[model samples]
Target: MAKTTSDLIVERLIDWGVDTIFGLPGDGVDGFFEALRTHQDKLRFVQVRHEEAAAFAAVGYAKYTGRIGVCVATSGPGGIHLLNGLYDAKCDLQPVLAITGHTFHDLIGMSYQQDVDLDKVFMDVAVFNERLMGPAHAENLVDMAIRAAYGRRGVAHITIPKDMQEWKVSDEQRSKANVPMHSADLAAPLAFRPATALLEQAAEIINKGSKVTVFVGRGALHAREEVEQLAELVGGPVVKALLGKGVLPDQSPYTTGGIGLLGTAPSVDAMNECDTLIMIGTSFPYMEFLPKPGQAKCVQIELDPTRVGLRHPVDVALTGDSKTILQALLPMLKKKDGKFLKKAQERMKDWNELLTDRGTRTDMPMKPQVVTHTLSRLLNDDAIVSADSGTIATWTARYVQMRGNMQFSLSGMLATMANGLPYSIGAAAAYPGRQVVCVVGDGGLSMLMAEIATLVKYNLNVTVIVVKNNVLGQIKWEQIVLEGNPEFGVELHPIDFAKVAEACGARGFTLERAEDAEAVLREALAHPGPSVVQAVVDPNEPPMPGKVTTDQALHFAKALLRGQKDASKIIKTLAEDQIREVV
Candidate 1:
């Protein structure tokens, strides 16, 4: 029997082991959508509100399942909407295949509706970009796209013309190309020599220096055991980046937690105290936090040669896979008894103790730390957490202890707002049986709150916990720190997020106080479908365990006095009346 080109594409996707596709269908891609309907038994199509959400869902799926997640979009605007998510996937090294429908071959260059240079636009984001000029090329392009996504651990885009989608071909005529699998093999002896020389130089520095620290990143995820072993061998502490959170267990004595603006005290102190710093699989961008050029010798190991010394001044650059370099460096390194290890371990203990005390506080109006701690406790052991950027990220990073099985997904590179809700929806769709939660801030939730409709439409069992503080907390914090006063634009008029959820066909609850939090969360989690728990918290509460300087404190006090004089007077009169009645 003859098969339509769309059928061939679906068949090829099935061959590539794709069980689900995240996307929206339109006129340009109607044929593909129709073709998907016929294969309903084998493949599940998840309809999302926007192409960007679909792309993000693909990223979530790939991150959790370690498979090539797929998303489809119509040409032009639909395809363009995918760039942000694609950039996230690309930077995070998540494997995703993006299939976009293009204008008909007959309409080529004539500016037909929804006709644009999708291949060219997607080129920078995707590891491989190709357009299907003919029906015969469809299978090969699909296979290549899948292969590129897997091998490069990034996004790949393939554009199919509407005319090509309607073409018919016999089963025998359809080409079947087997995609190549990724291998962990090293290139050659020359590749080893350069890396070996760099490793030797790094070892010499470690041997001479009494204090050395190891900083791990996402690139080191695959070589965690080796990285840990190296850390132990050197008796140095291992600090990870946000993306590298679960690569090494947080409870490990060698683990010093993450470093950056959102980093913990242990990581900062360890990094600053170390005489030599070894960076593995992380191109951490904050040069201000990194050691000065001549302060502490810096050694970096990365797979991409271009990334070497790009951010910080690298005294030694090793170009290879993390595991490969670590394996080679293991035998050459000499074990040393150093104070760096003991000092870092002690600092880690103190930092953890401080975080635990702060997080467990039973304060009125509810502390962000307490909220995150309670959420962490209530969440399923294997629940996938998608956190949006801002103060919530800082809180979650500090308090939420991720287990090995619990996956944490984030828009690391893009740091885009409104990502948490859609990302969680995608995560829930990808892993339907697992509990998926989106810990979002008020500002971020407002950005893509409409995705709640997508959740209801799909009946995805995802819980969204909106931290309704009525302001961009991170921006507010920055204003306090850098500007020395409250900014006008940081404040937001409160919205009824629970009502918004209810209107979107999902269950909703408003948390009025700290005591109401646990019960509200439980009800949301127990709901059969999507639910939003709007946690109302004090807008003026500062982040815990973070100190304000004397000058900043004085400024804050003066601002409070000037701003709340009338309110303070009313409070004082009430207190005086109560005292007089008691007397």
Candidate 2:
């Protein structure tokens, strides 16, 4: 039999080192599935319960491995379901390729069943989007799509018509007679360095200020040593963006924790007091948490010139690889007194002490911080941990200490729910035998609860810690704190996620009392297969901002006066947590 487009695409995927493809099969893409069956030994297909989970898994795989992730779906609704996850990949700058099926080429514009003009729908989300024209278009199109996804660090999409999936390519079409044959090996990533003159200018700006603070983001993940060196050389405290939480450990003396709403007081203070701000490999979006415009001399080092000065006004913008740029610029820096760093360290010590006290509370309704902090203690040193959006993200950000070789990620830019489990699935797939954990709120877990079966099907060793508060805790607080309104339509019906996990052939543990948290989590994490720990926590615990203004305090008071359902409980929990801080 002659080679078909489906076979050619699968072969090309293996060439590019894609070991797995996450998707759900439909008749529209049966030919591709058949091709996958033939190549099952070479490539694995992870069948997800939903197309969105498939896409999210792909994004997570890319994030963990720094390689292109591939996801597939059928025509129309299947393709549309992938939009949220694909947007997450795009917003976080992860390289992912999405392949979807289409209607027969003959019936494309006739408004046939499940016929979506996917190319048009995908234009804004993908760096490269196309529909396979014919058998001859397969090789070049696959090559170009993968290349575009890698080079641009965004999504690449392709829609294949059902009729064309089995169309055989002639020998001449495979040869260079009609189209140029492409190589399977990917070109090395560009390692450009900024000019020496530009580095010196940034250095001079850094040297001129005594109160320097370094800000790092996801881009600095690989430049940890360089970042530390620069901080040490300038005697500045390093503040991390939420996505860059793992770049430096919270235990480091030169560091304060995260910035923004889910950040620490020391980080906010560092930004406010610094006369010079050095941003490296980050485009942190919370401008309010940064220094006032022109209040600090700023220098931004980024790999993409287009994103160089995006988040702030910079006196010097140097575009290059983060590790390389920092290495080149470190030597030109002058040493300063450690007074600024020492002060920040003092603040961090107080902050850490407060967190420890909060996380160790033995109150009736358990604090969510205790769950995350306990999980942090039980996690393997090199575990890959992911958190779902909502108050769970806040808990994970504040309590889960990143040390050793631990890796952390979440729906950073998209801030979408239901990504927690899928990300763990992807992480487990990326590195088998390594420990993986997903910390999620009840609302987010309920959104994709069926994935519990996916975990069982693969026997992936992932421990999901579900914080069941019986309400949308994050949105509830946002209403009171940010909007000054009484909470409405934010409650979630309680779910016994542990029972659900057992129904899906996984181990399940339930923790209602605060004392049971550590043991329950330890057993779940060591279960050897997929496990779920349903932890019922306090709903009234607030996810307060790092730096709250008087306006926010007024808003909370107004919300309580406007008849919040749990006004009394809210005040009690808030006072308990706040009282600990003052002492």
RMSD of each: 6.1, 1.7
Which residue runs does candidate 1 get wrong by more than 4 Å?
170-201, 457-459, 483-485, 526-528, 543-583
Per-residue lDDT over 1-583 for candidate 1, one digit per residue giving the tens place of the 0 to 100 score: 5788889789888877789899989887887888899998888998888888888888878876777889999988999988888888998888899989899878868978887989989878989999886656667677777877877778999888877787776533433452333222221221343545667887787666667889888778777788878887788888888877777877777788887867777787777777788899887777766666777887788877888988777888887778888888888777878567788889778778877776666555566666777787787768888898888888777777776667776778777776788778767877889988889899998877888998998899999988888889887756654455544587788899999999999999987666666788888888999999888775655552232345555554444444432334323432432321210
Give candidate 2's error at residue 353 in angstroms. 0.4
lDDT of 2 by residue, 157-254 (tens): 99999988988777324445654564454746867888889989999999999999999999999988998898888898999998899899878888
TM-score of 1: 0.86
| Candidate 1, run of 10 with poorest lDDT | 182-191
Worst 10 residues of 2 by lDDT: 171-180
Give stretches of model 2 more than 4 Å off: 171-177, 182-184, 579-583
Best by TM-score: 2
lDDT of 1: 0.77
* TM-score to true structure, per model: 0.86, 0.98
